[model samples]
Target: MLLKPITPCLWYDGQAKEAADYYVSIFPNSKITSVQKFNDSHKAVTDQDTGSVLTVAFELNGQPFVGLNGGPHFKFNEAVSFTIQCKDQAEIDYYWDKLGEGGDESKQRCGWLSDRFGVSWQVVPAALVELMVSSDPEKAKKTTAAMLQMKKFDIAALKAAGDS
Candidate 1:
């Protein structure tokens, strides 16, 4: 049973365990909690060999997720993404670099990146929303403009733009 009532499950062709391990390594207070394997009963339904990884249950920063070793009939796309609201530039940089490693460079824009697993992530400063929604219309516009130009968020630059 998952610790959370609703958990996001990622579908991978045969890299469920690998993906789970990679994710857990990046986030603090994260770990692979359980692993399920396919058995003879599932032979008729799945191409995976018996004893192969079926699903990996893991947690990243207390958020529960499952990686299913489903066949590659589906793929992850920009339609869905996980947002990491970082407290500072350092946090932003850490997550940006860590998750963006081995990712597709062409997909990076406005603090969004697509990792090696084809998972999309938005690594933005926690203060970005406030800056973008400021009472001052010019500040909000400038902040938004500044944000649009960067792949990885520069909090100081954003703040400067908001202040200007």
Candidate 2:
């Protein structure tokens, strides 16, 4: 398939294929688009084995992304993150648990967590955004406050807080 106009590229030390497969497994509407291996001509520049994975193109929930085995010079940080907007509690739970597995719980806060590869992700309820932008400023404030204190968002709790 042709690439998207703009695709987010994830740099990995050497787990590009592994990360792509794991992400594909987690999201129901996702798949690996393509995989490229380092060739003899490129091996000298990349310092990778000729047959090692060079890049992996994948889709997560329909969003296209590329994962590159670009060595350890760069690392993922909180500055870049993917947010999954969930319609309900079940969706939120599924994402939070799956993405948070093998991650540092302490580093997680306010619906944000890092995967095993240290890629930051936010599993949030769709309602939270609506609540935060509601016409009632008080409701928005309450919901925002409630969300600020959560590691994994509880949609019911946020709604209750907004109502109160």
Candidate 3:
């Protein structure tokens, strides 16, 4: 049996290229592979301007993704989100700050943020999983409590909570 790669497609209202560029800039080992423009056939179906961005193929940290300029028929919501696992506090901070810039402040909570493009992202520390599943139930509970109160996760604070 052969395994095929799965790529997540993000639909945007004519901002696919812009969003893809932004994502490529922020993530390491990322780049825009291609930009497809709408043709006469697409214009007939989608009513989008011919020659406009139809899709953008890109990779982030080696993960393949496609950004489609599919118009305003759909929208991004909290139900779906991309999670960035960070190795440490510094990494968490870097991703949080970069991805959260120009984002909706009201949507920021519990390490989740909605970017300017309305895409939700979870910038979480890798240690968060271990803390949440600690063998000591009390430590896990305290760590979870601390985590719930923070918009941006603080690894040190979570560690202290677990220790306490």
- Misplaced by over 4 Å in model 1 are none
lDDT of 2 by residue, 39-134 (tens): 999955878998899999999989999999999999998999999989899999999999899987877999999999999999988876687777
Clashing residue pairs for model 1: none
Better of 1 and 3 by lDDT: 1
Clashes of 3: 0
Alpha-carbon lDDT, every model: 0.92, 0.92, 0.91
The deviation in Å at residue 18 for candidate 2 is 0.3
Q: Write the per-residue lDDT of candidate 1 for residues 89-128, one digit (tens) a residue.
A: 8999999999999999999999999999999999988887
Q: TM-score for all predictions?
A: 0.96, 0.94, 0.95
lDDT of 3 by residue, 3-66 (tens): 1277889999999999999999999999998888999987558888889999999989988899
Error of 1 at 80 (Å): 0.8
